[model samples]
Target chain A: MEAFTQHTGKIVPLDRANVDTDQIIPKQFLKRVERTGFGQYLFYNWRFDTQGNPDPDFELNQEKYADGSILLSGANFGCGSSREHAPWALLDYGFRVVIAPSFADIFYNNCFKNGILPIRLPEETVNTLFQRVAQEITHTLTVDLEANKMEDHNGFSAEFKVEPYRRYCLLNGLDDIAVTLQKADKISSYEKNLPSYYQVQEKQNL
Target chain B: MKPRTLFEKVWDRHVIDQEEGKPATLYIDLHLVHEVTSPQAFEGLRLNGRKVRRPDLTVATMDHNVPTTNRNLPITDETSAKQMNTLAKNCKEFGIRLYDLDDPGQGIVHVIGPELGLTLPGKTIVCGDSHTSTHGAFGALAFGIGTSEVEHVLATQCLQQLKPQTMEVHVKGTLSPGVTAKDVILAIISEIGTDGATGTVIEYTGEAIRNMSMEERMTVCNMSIEAGARAGMVAPDETTFRYLENRTFVPKGEAFEQAKQLWRQLQTDEGASYDKRVVLDASNIAPQVTWGTSPGMGSAVTDRVPDPDSFQSDAERKSARRALEYMGLKPGTPMSEIPVDRVFIGSCTNSRLEDLRMAAQVVKHRKVAPGVRAMVVPGSQEVKKQAEAEGLHEIFLHAGFEWRESGCSMCLAMNDDVLSEGERCASTSNRNFEGRQGRGGRTHLVSPMMAAAAAVHGHFVDIRNWTFKD
Candidate 1:
């Protein structure tokens, strides 16, 4: 995972609410064994027509949103499915930060694991950002995760909250697997003295 | 001892480490893996030169991308077949036990977990799929995880996690005859919006939940994620113990009795505090059907299609209008009048034997409607075998329904058994999200009986007064 102390990028506004992972990186593209290469198929159905041409009518297809690294989406973004492919695609597509009114629990945790910052501003604030981005010639925001704040070059600024542990992991690019293995003794002890009921014997007979 | 909730008790038992400014490091007792979300996790392990931390604790099966029609024929889809092969190779390399496609034990991950007696009371379980909440019915603390956490668990068998706030859904009174567990849960999701349970784990209690069968309890817990809940649980009782007893993998005789005593203690302590409480009158619940995309758009069968203008919020109204447009449905029409092109009755949600029997009872000696193509795909090979032994498959076949082998057929439509674009289906699956069944496919979520009844009528029908042709 890449450390995320700060990122300043253009905001691409997606105005729909309840944007599920099924739409983020549809299930069809989930077949690849490796996590990379999903960015090409991100929002496949929404982004392309039946003939494989990118639909110009789609929000992200418009020129203004192209090459934008910051995604400002609707409430409950990445709602359905626990596939981390949704975050993998978002990260692979060059999105460093995702700002929404809210996000699904699994998706939020996934974004942090992939180093894509998911920030939850109030719904009203998100609406204002969407409006401001639409009106501005080129709207960019700098998110200082270390300072727990987001700001635009103009006059907009707001404080955000991420749990201390999650923030620490993101700021330091910590691998959770290594951090958990440090307490290997605790896990082994619990398994060694397990009750008879908790014992899971080998199922060689099956 | 201070009274503790069922969740707190489970959480406390699993916590190996908790430090200031850090979440607890909780041990995972059971890790269920499947084809779709796990390949990347396994690849991560190989790249890091890591072996599975606990092969004994891990289980694997193929479900999401399996075909329901073909038994021996090689999978025709190149991508799906390769993905399935990847899982088999990874499981063998990692020393994890896998229930192959030909194995009788093979089934949907959630179904096989409980069927094999692996999903036990008071255990902390996880899978790389959202509906892992389905295992919570056994009084276990089960939730879905992302592939990264899947890889983390595979490498360390532990996850750093926070204690989510708890919510109690208390449903009292008896469920009506046609009102099944599916109906009860749909009604609850309707009461609370899709995101209502966000950031919380829901504990379903009261007479309605207590009186349900193990299969029915699973049906209720399976859709917790649809309401944005992290997990759903029901405290273990005699009903729960009876379901696991004598099953494979559970302790035997004297050991089982001793286990029973501890399992009994998994209940929420009397006078335990809860963060929030929402009560439902189970007797009032009717057969449910989702008219729109999200499961939260569900309504009683007798209700009319809601006008988008009826919604109070700006977002909701707009969403409703788009849903109606995408679903190709007209507002103000009675639900029973809505016609469906197909009827599918199987998913992790309602594909157990009990659900099959419930559907068979409605379609017995009757015929499917002329225009409706109805299919019954059992959830597991074990379920398929059991349904065959009881002639449930015959009841479905005699009714013009297609009886097929076990797999996750058309639930998410990852297999060949998918609906064509613009086709409408009365399905027993959980989500009705746009393109969930397939692109441009419209699904109306229903109970087994409701789905069977709809198949005969060629449209959605109110099952409360449905009369069997037989």
Candidate 2:
């Protein structure tokens, strides 16, 4: 995971609501043991043809949005599947931020764990961002986690909400395992005194 | 002070640690693992040089990609075999309990969890699969988590979660015969679109939910994730206790009575307030079927496909239009008249023995419609054995349906059991997303009985009017 303060990048407008995780990354590409190479398979069904050639009509493949590091999407982004692959693929694909009207709970939590910031703006505000980004390839927005603010250089700006703890974790590049390990002593103490069935045994019969 | 909801009662008791600004650290009682989403989490633990903190609480099994046929032979698919091999190796090295392919208890993670008595009332359960909500039928606060959280739980035996607000769905009126829990859940999804219960855990109550059998309660809780709520629950009652009475893993003797005493308290306090409320008249809900790519885009079997123009928002109208196109359905077409090329009557959603019996009763003396391929895949080996004892498999096989081994098959079309491009299927599985059954495939969601009826009729039909042949 990487620390986040602020990021400014060209916006990619995905004009679809309830964009589920399966559409973000299909099931076929989840076979690999490693997580790094999933970016190539992101949106595999929509981004590629049967011949494995990139489809230019897809929003991400369009020349103007090719280098986008920020996504301005419709409401209820990442609505299905609890796969962390959705966030891993987005991060691998050069997306540092996802701005939507709202997000599914598991998907939203996963974004923070993977260091990809997900900002929930009002539906109208998100619609305005999409419209502005659609007008030109160079339209960009800046997300400042420290300030809880998003701004476009053209004077459009809005505020977002993030919990203080999640903000602190993201600002410091703190992964959950590392934070949870802080209570290792307490965890060990609790495990030491568990009952018979709760303890692991050697060569136990079923 | 207001009375607390059942969710708050269970959640508050599990809070082991709470910091002023951070999410609460709630201890977990059980963690269910499967082949697909767990490989990476095990690998992460290996890379970090960490061991499972509580191996006793963790259980692993092979599902998701296992073939429904050829259980006696080796797993033929390279990717599927590799995933299963990795899980077996990891479980052995970590000393976690595993129910491999040949194990009688081996089945879908959600199915085995309940049947083996690992799922109990007042426990906090977590799994890497979304259908973990299936265990919430026993009054457990079970929900799905991502693989990263899976690793976190494996290492610490606890999770940091922000509490979700509660939503209560009250279903009044007696359900008509042939109307099942599948109809109730599908109707709920249709009433409230996909994201209606976002960030909330739903508690189903009232006469309709109370009268359901344990298996039927599991069926209703199973698809809660389809509504974007990761957790759904029904409070423990006499029905729940009866189901767990003599199960292998449940407490026995005096321990059982003590457990029951505590479980009796695991209900909502009278006058409890919820963050949101929904009311449904279960009697009015008919046998339902999804018409489009989403579970929410469903209607009663007797209704016609909805026109996109009927929607107010552009987003809704555009989504409807795209769904209709992908589903190969015309706007005015009757749902029952929609033809099917295949019928799948299995999944974590509806693959219990009771579910199998429902389908068998419909297909006893009837033959599958010509050119319609149908199959009945049981949820687990235990479910299969029970079905076999009741002669349900013979009924299905004699009626021209394939009686296959137990595992997830054609639900997401991850294995050889898949619908080819442009094929339409009547499926009992949750989710009708594009390519869910295969690339360019279309699915109509139905119950086990409706799926059997569809196989015989070669299309979606109202089970209320369906008649078995002499």
Each candidate's root-mean-square deviation in Å?
A: 1.3, 1.6
True-contact fraction per candidate equals: 0.61, 0.41
Q: Model 2 has how many clashing residue pairs? A: 0
lDDT of 1 by residue, A55-116 (tens): 99887788978888999988899899999999999888889999999999999999999998
Tens digit of per-residue lDDT, candidate 2, span B273-321 = 9998999999899999999888899999999999999998988998899
TM-score of chain A of each: 0.95, 0.92
lDDT by residue (tens digit), candidate 1, B1-470 = 99999999999999988998799999999999999999989988888888899888888999999888766998899999999999999888888888989999999888988998999999999999999999999999999999999999999989999989999999999998888999999999999978889999899999999999999999999999998999999999999988998887788899899888988999899999889889999989999999998999999999999999999988889899989999999999899999989999999999999999999999998889998999998989999999999999999999999998888888888888888889999999999988888888999999999999999989888788977655
- Candidate 2 off by > 4 Å: A185-204
Interface RMSD of 2: 2.0
Which ranges in model 1 have alpha carbons more than 4 Å from their true place?
A: A196-203
- DockQ for each model: 0.67, 0.56
What TM-score would chain B receive for each of the candidates shown? Answer: 0.99, 0.99
Superposed by TM-score, candidate 2 places the C-alpha of residue B358 at a distance from the truth, in angstroms, of 0.6
